[model samples]
Target chain A: MTVPSRILVVDDDADIRTLLGEYLRRHGFQAEGACDGASMRERLHRAEFDLVVLDLTLPLEDGLDVCRDLRTRSDVPVIMLTARGAPIDRSVGLEIGADDYVAKPFEPRELLARIRAVLRRTTGKASAVRPEATRHIRFAAWTFDPTARHIVNAAGVIVALSGSEFRLLRAFLEHPRQVLSRDRLLALTSGSDVDAFDRSIDLQVSRLRQKLRDDAKAPLLIKTIRSEGYMLACHVTEPA
Target chain B: MTVRVFVILVLGILFAIAGTLHATAIFHGPPFRPTLQLSVLGICTLSLAFITARMVTRPLRGLAGAATRLGRDIDAAPLPVTGPTEVKDASMAFNAMQRRIRANVSERTGMLAAITHDLQTPVTRLRLRVEKVEDDDLRARLIGDLASMSDMIRDGLEWARSIDVAEPFGRLDLDALLDSVCSDAQDAGHDVVLREESAAIVLGSVSALRRCFTNVIDNAVAYGGRADVSCVVDGARAIVRVRDSGPGLSDHQLGSVFDPFYRVEASRSRATGGTGLGLTITRNIVVRHGGTVSLRNRAEGGLEVTLDLPLAGAE
Candidate 1:
């Protein structure tokens, strides 16, 4: 008899708020809607919410402002819904203690996956609060800008990673020198929503190894453990 | 004003010639040493003509340089109105024209940004609402249509952004960039191959150049089924050829392919899913980097897009 997670959807458009509310509810969450920041604050005051899906473009007081204010008072997870191609807003949202972001015009399934991933990460207490400051993750001659979602090599060349590749790399960077099982890797990278298999994880790992220029037969950076899983054999550092 | 300057220049030269002749007649004896006098007159006329020509052309040269600067940067400073009356008038007119063009460009960009920004909310709403459709087939088709619509909207915004030259230029490895783009395309299951690459370093806006190549490759993949890309540095220019295996375009279509909204196969574009602005944006980015992009039907049966970019420190 476990209670479902409570979610709050904050958007100016009534139709959007209602639709997202219904969608979240149908996905087994107790969802509530707020038309703007003022009502969002009132909802928070009245009830407890595990997550807040805040839209960046809201009337009068915007989502960023609301999220910033909420961060000062509470540690509740905030997921920003930003416009596509608004990279600045996305980075700023993440910098302001928001947990994750889903670009607008996104697939509903994608949003659901993001919501689930954020909830899982938060509840698991893997580094309780997301680092408030934006930092670049450096590992073995590669620099990863989590905000920009790209990797730069020692030669100062930027390499763009596909979404899954980025998530996989981030997971490895976050936990270096530890063998990550296929199931754990899949959960971290694709969330639980995707019907991915162990082979897909292997394929993704091989592709990533190719990008890193690591030989598959005798890999140097990412080593495959016998009967265990993959482990990043390099030291990872987060440089400001 | 120019005519007046010309008249004065002519009069000054005539006076100098007459003075030189008078001096030669008075100073020299009977025959006047015609050879020396003629040489002296020729030297005087030549010196006067050279000085007058320089004086007149200096103002024109300044105006020409300013015009060239304006062509490269719309926000270039106005020409200094400190020359002869005609030159001043011409510069003033040029400055006014520059101002008008800047205003118009900003206005159009602002409007496009506003429209794109406003469209996102409703599109998102529609996407969410459409998910509730009971019929699975109808829902999938509706989602497909919405996805394409969103793609067009996103492309429109990108096209508008391509006009902005605010991106910082950096030295980029052409081979590495091509490798990444091709690899990414391959990862996406697009039939793209980087057949050849050279260690070519180019000075360009990294994102803009990336977008340019991506659009070209995407276009090739969408229409041509596959893209065979090759890059080589020839002397001072890095030449990249993206060859596609699609049916080659007609001569008329080739001429208009880069034109905005001009799709070679209009009906095919709907199926392939592009706003027909890919090549247009590609050209915009290439030209901004002082590069030239051209498309031609391959002799063997396909279309080849050639991009010639100046290597870093070469130009």
Candidate 2:
């Protein structure tokens, strides 16, 4: 038997609270609702939740304050709902420890995906998969650091990787020397973007190879196993 | 300013005539030497008057140029309050009015934010409720229609907030930014290629520029079958051209493409979830960065959108 995840939906709108609760329940999760920060605190006292869907604007107490309080008190995953596509609100939401953000008029499916991703991130040690805490991954005389969002080459020059490149490289390091299929790489690296197996992975790999100084004509590091998938043809280790 | 130029020219002519008469009378009727000296004096005075008039018109031209520059980017450095007191006062007043205009626009954006903020809750509620529609096709259609409506309203809010750029300017690598955007578009299954990379440095709002390029590139991929993006450092401007191999816009329809909510056809973008606000927001952000964006139908086949953004030292 498997235990269903408990989700708390916090919004001033009663209709949203009810709809989210019903929707999550229909999807085989234990769901509950709270109108504002006070009722949310009461619910927290009575039970534990696996995640929180928090709205940024609220009555009496703002959602940021509630999130701050939740961060100090517990480790519940928080997904912020922002009003517009304002970059500032997204930054502030992340800076204040919200795990992820979704803009208004969002597809429920999108939010559901974010919730699952956040849950996977938070439910450590309980699952078979490992967490992404490794700071520096070394491979083929190069230092790939996820925290710094850069990679250091053999000549000790730091090269910045784009967001997608960093995610794709990290996916490679997680399973080195294994011929991972395009589908697997897409699943591992997919976020809001790159939701499918596309030529983007091939292009990203080529660009990453160029940065790593891997020979594109006869690649030594990331090799393409034709008719199969791609493999990081190198020994990867964590550098202290 | 033209009126001032006309007044200065009239004054210069009057001064020239008056000086000629004065020189003639001062020398009286001396035959050779006096006449030669008076001619020299008269010519010198007229030239002096003409040069002074030119000097007066110079700052006026500066003011006009400053106005045009300020129109493009509100954050551009204000007109230096030099020159005559009247000019100084005008420059100072213009700067103050620019600040007021900026504040007023931002205030309007703030209000739009408030109203849109209230709207999201209901929209979210309605979307969630639509999941219980029972009929598979009905549920999907309701969800899709609701999602489009939400996107449209969100675009409305984003359109209002477009003028409000709260991001700070930073030293951005142009090549890297373009590469990232094209890569993202390519990842989303678009045929986007970064053909050329001419790296340049620019002081601009990173987020705003990113959104600007993404919007343009997205339009290319959506409308054009494929997108070929390139960057070049042409003097002080970083020129970015995004060309797509799709059916280009007709000449008559091109002028209205950037208008808010203006769609070439009702069904074209609606199916793709485009709110028709992408170009509007892109234009607002590019103009905020002292850039000009233009679109033209390429004779070879598709649409080509070019953006020329001023570099840090260009202006």
- Writing each residue's lDDT as its tens digit, candidate 1 over B171-230 gives 777876777677667767788988765878888766678889999998888888999999
**Per-prediction backbone clash count:** 0, 0
For model 2, name the residue pairs that clash.
none
Model 2 chain B worst lDDT window (10 residues)? B29-38
Name the runs in model 2 displaced over 4 angstroms. Answer: A125-163, A169-188, A192-195, A198-240, B1-32, B36-40, B47-51, B75-114, B266-269, B311-315
Q: Give fnat (model 1).
A: 0.38
> What DockQ do the predictions score, one after another?
0.39, 0.35
DockQ, prediction 1? 0.39
lDDT minimum window of 10 residues, candidate 2 chain A:
A125-134
Our model 2 lands, by Cα RMSD against the true structure, at 6.6
Listed per model, the TM-scores of chain A against the true chain A are: 0.83, 0.64
